[model samples]
Structure formats: structure tokens, C-alpha cells
Target: MADILTLETPRLRLRTWCDEDLAVLAAISADPEVMRHFPAPLDRDEAAAMLRRIRDHFAAHGFGLWALERKDEGQLIGFTGLGWTGFDAHFTPAVEIGWRLARDQWGQGFAREAALAALAAGFERLGFAEIASFTALSNRRSQRVMQAIGMHRDPADDFDHPKLAEGHPLRRHLLYRLRLDEWRERCP
Candidate 1:
């Protein structure tokens, strides 16, 4: 319907979210392991709001978190792409590349495959000089993805997330960055 909205990797496809994705989104958001890094698990309304926000981002920015789908089964898996981390003293106008896969899809490399496509879009199409990703200190899996993508932690730039309250477990985060120049040098 929306040009199939596809971003391709060797084994995965990043596509636009369809109406069918809501259930998967809700399930993922409701998962304790998935929600562990978030301030709290989203209720239906909050989850719906997240969908609207990501959809609006694509409408406004031409690219956002493209819904990740399995090329083999065409099932909606999760999301991986770029988003505005919102402005702050420590982070401003940042393009954050992230991925979240369903529990069923974990340990299969889908997150990495889809995220690599998003990285290509960020640097090549969106003209981002650097793509940044952040996660709570406890989210070692996500941190691994950052490193696998050639990102490195910048401790001096780390800050408490502005959106989270003072005592939120996810407030204190580590920032990892991958510059376009660095990607070019490393991948070239």
C-alpha cells in the first residue's frame, strides 16, 4: 500500500508498519525482558501512541523506524531504524539507530541484519554524520549490537536520559556513536 516501504539486507527486510503489526508491537512492549530497559511497560494507549509517533516520523521525515519483517514468512517481527532522540544539553539533533526484535526472533541475527540496513539509510540517505544508540547499563545485548556495528561508547557524553525521572533505572545510560566517516573507513 505504501510502496511496500522496504529496506533490504542479505537476509531481512525493513518495511513500513502495517495495521497487522499492532498486536506484535503490543506483545513486544508487554514483554518483561523487552520492557526491562524501558521505564515501564506500555499499556495499550501508550503502545498506540508509540505507533503513531513512529508513523508520524516517517510522514514528516521521510524515514523512521521501518517495521522489520521476515522475508521468508512476511510476518511482522519488530522495528529497526533511526529516530530523533529529542534535544538536550548532552544530546541534540541526534539520529539514534535502534532495533527491537520479538522474543521469538532473538538469537537469529535479524536485529543485526535489519539494523545494518537502517545504518546504511542513515548515513547514505539521511546524511547523518554520526548515528548514535543508547541503552541502560543492564542491556548488554543491545550494547553488543552497538559494538558489532562499529560504534564505541563515549563516556564523556553520557548523561541521564531527560525523559526518565530521577530514580528511573534507565535514567543513567551509555551513549555509543558511529560516525559516517568511520563507517566508511571500516567498511571500505
Candidate 2:
């Protein structure tokens, strides 16, 4: 296995995924409420496949969605970190920051805290010039987190997700971006 990279915040630990995390991750993926913004809730087999892809992403790029663990409870909540955007768009071939926490963990600011740490790693450690994040038009919660982390959205950057069918309700997405210089201005 590649050396697992871990990022820490006040209340959460974002670390590489592990064998033990599969069950909880599967559970999180299966939650209809948690998967509401996604195409559909993943079944166990599909969730396992997702985990494999996450692992492969780390192997290929050195960073992927980290397993989110609550420090106080020491339990897997979900995942948050950076990944490459695979679709063709204006923002194609960009690093994307993202997160998904268990429903019970929402409204507690865990996602924001963890995401800030991930952004720091992307900017400070990985030396990325810019990081992008996008969500369906209806995913206000994720959009809020993107804004909270100092990402800016340009209405002109909005585009339909190529992975989704042309007429799908979730096809329309809003892109948010933060450049290294912008991150320095906001964080430093």
C-alpha cells in the first residue's frame, strides 16, 4: 500500500481508506438521504467497486477521498478530500475538493473543517495551482461548504455534467474554483 496520507482538524481526521472502512463506507453510500444528490444510492457491490476506484485513484494520483473519522467518537463518518474531475468541461482535468458525511454528522461543521484541511494540503503540499468543486443545482449544502472554504463561483462557469444524461434533473451543475493566489489571500 502507498504511504497513507492523513490530514487532521479540530474534530475530524481525514485519512486514507482502509479495509475496515468498507462496511461504514458502504453504509454511507447506501443511505438514500446521503446519496440524494448522487445518481442513486449504491448497493454493497457497487460501494465496493467505488472503494476500489478510490484506492486506484490514490495509487495513480497520490491523493483521493480520505475516510472521514470523527476524533471524539473514533468512528468512520464518511469521506472528504481531493480527486480529479474525469469529465470533459471547461474545468476538466482539475483537482476537485469534495465531502460526504453521515447524516447524523451534518450541521456540526465537520465537513467544512475537514475540507479546509484538504484545501490546505492541495495548496501547500501538493502545490496545485487551483482546486475546483461542483455540485448539482439543487445541492445547496455542498455549495455552502464550497463558499465557506473561500471558493468563488462564476455563473458563466456553470455547465451540464457530461456523465449525466442530457435531460437529467441533476445534469446541471455549478462550478466553484479557488486558485493558489486566492487561497493565500484568504488563508494567510
Candidate 3:
């Protein structure tokens, strides 16, 4: 699987992660405000492990995450991409699209722009029939983004994250799905 060197959107660039991304990733993981819906803020070791897995995913799949940078400034504000996610029972064997940006970047439409680029890669380039997006039940901002990107909610597809303990605020999550047919329907 050869690495994907670049994926572009109007105001964003989705490219392979590099060593320089370590500090940017660490900043997001350590920010409680940024990680509010996650089970817990990641420590440096956990952050390091995640980046390792992300790189390994790229090596194995050829197309994994593309760390997002501002098109104009080349700043690593955060990342958005489609990745394989199997932990959720309802959406097993799913190629899930997701995004996380610096808190400062919220409400500016970066997540949606970056995510649409990822969705295009998954549905058009990778041949996935459908891609799913999910977030903790209370994470309304994410839910709205899913809707804005033309995804539809299926509460019946909700699942408690396997990594989260019972009764955890982040345990129950909602799913949003968009099929290739649906994407075509929207544009055609």
C-alpha cells in the first residue's frame, strides 16, 4: 500500500502524518476541552501509541488518516480522515470517517470541509459502499457536522463504545451513515 501524499479541499490539505505532528497531536489530546467527549484525555504515552497505530494503518491499508493542515498556513490544526473501526457492534467492519480540530478551529467549517474530502476518498477512491461517523451521544457539535455532510442518524445503530466502562458519559454513542448511493444522490 503506497502512501497517499495529498488530498485537498477548498481551504484544507489532508496529507500523511509526519514527525512534526507529534506536538500538535499532543496538544489536542491533552486539552480537556478538545477531548471532552472521549473517555479520558490521553497522556503522552497513549498519544504516542495512537500515532504509531495510525502510521501502521497507513502502511497496511495504503489509505488511512490524512493529518489536516490549513491550506494557506500549513498549520497542523488537527486531522480528519476515514479509518477502519470495529469496536462498535452496530457498525462493525465499518470504515468510519472522523475529525478533530483545535478548539480555535471550531465553527469555522474546517471539520466539515476536511471530512467531505475524506468521504470522497472512502466512497470513490477506496470503494467502500458506505462510511459511518459517530460521536458520544452528547456531542451535539459532531452530530450536527454529520448532518451537515448529508449523513442521516440511525439511533437504532447506537452502541456503547467497547473501550468505555459502563455508565461512562462517553460510553453510549450515536451513529450517522452515508452510502455511496446517497452521496451520488445529493450531487446528481
Candidate 4:
């Protein structure tokens, strides 16, 4: 088998998706608590489709939402990485850093650990000028992860996600950003 693209952090490994990850990802996707910030939980087929998309993105762009693995136990947790926003918005054409972990993995600092590794790749290796992340106004946990990685939210940049219908509870979102210069300053 060809070697998978992988990035390592102190406590986690962010690697390209594999066929084996679908079942665990499906479980994570179907968990209501895990999907709370999203519109709804995904069924098996939807989860599989998402995995296909992630795989395709990596094939096309050389990077996408990598499957996150805990280094200690070598278990699949979820995913974290950078992806093209792929929608028309004020931020269209942007690359966003994002993550999702199994509910049981919450509060373990894994998301932050993986996210910082993703940011390093996006900024230092990929040569991106900036990366952005956004979530439902109510997804404070994800927002906290964004902040922990040195992303700053600009309320004026908040937006209604076009994919969500008007007045959808998860439509309104808060935008956070981290520029290469900012990340460099924060890290160096």
C-alpha cells in the first residue's frame, strides 16, 4: 500500500483517511451529541459519502480533513485539518482549519493538539496566507478550540451560512481567522 500523508503532534497523528476509518467516523457522525452543532446526525450512507469526499479532497488538493488518531492508544478519534470552504460566501475560496472528535474524546485537548499541527502545515508547509474557521453561534466548544489555536473572531465577519435555510438555528455563524504573520508571531 502507498504510504499515507501524515502529520504528527505531541499527542496525536493527523493522517489521510483510510477505508478502515469509515465505521468509526460513522459512529461519530451519528452520535447526536457529536452532531449537535451540525444540522443533524448522519446515517451510515451519509457518513460514507463524507468519507469519499474527504478522500477525494486529499487526492485533489494534497490535504483535507485528515483522520485524527490518538498516539497513546492508536485509536481513531475523528478529524482535523484544512479544507477549501467550497461555498460562496464572503469567505469563499478560503481554506479553513477545522476538527471533530468523538463525544467521548471531548475535554482531552486532542482537538487543540491536532489543530495546532494542522495550522503549522497550512502556514509553514502549505504556504497559506491565512486560514479561517467558523461554527454555529452556539458551538462554544469548537469556538474555544479555534481560540486556543490563536484564531481571532471578528463579529462583523459573522455570517448566515447560505447552505442553511433562512432562520435555521445553525445558520448564523461566527468567523475566526489566523493570518500567517499572526501565527508566526504567536509561535516564534
**Once model 1 is optimally superposed onto the true structure by TM-score, how far is the C-alpha of residue 39 displaced, in angstroms?**
0.9
TM-score of each: 0.93, 0.96, 0.95, 0.97
Q: TM-score winner between 1 and 2, please give it.
A: 2
RMSD of 3: 1.4
lDDT assessment of candidate 1:
0.83
User: Across residues 1-188, which tens digit of lDDT does each residue of candidate 2 receive?
Assistant: 23338988889889888888889999988999999999999998998999999999998988889999989989999999999988789778899999988898899999999999999999988889999999999999999999999999999999999999989999999999999999999888
As a whole number from 0 to 100, the lDDT of residue 42 in candidate 2 is 94
What ranges in model 4 sit over 4 Å off? 1-4
Q: Comparing candidate 2 with candidate 3, which one achieves the higher lDDT?
A: 2
Cα RMSD (angstroms) for every candidate in the order listed: 2.5, 1.7, 1.4, 2.3
lDDT of 1 by residue, 1-188 (tens): 12225698877888878777888898888888888888788877787889999998888778888888888888888899888876584767788988888888998988877887888778877778998999988899999988888899978988888888899877888899999999889866
Model 3: how far residue 73 lies from native, Å:
1.1
Model 4, 28-142: lDDT tens digits are 9999999999999999999999999998888888889999998889999999988899789987789998888999999989999999988988888888899999999999999
Worst 10 residues of 3 by lDDT: 1-10
Name the lDDT of candidate 4: 0.91
Stretches of candidate 3 off by over 4 Å are 1-3
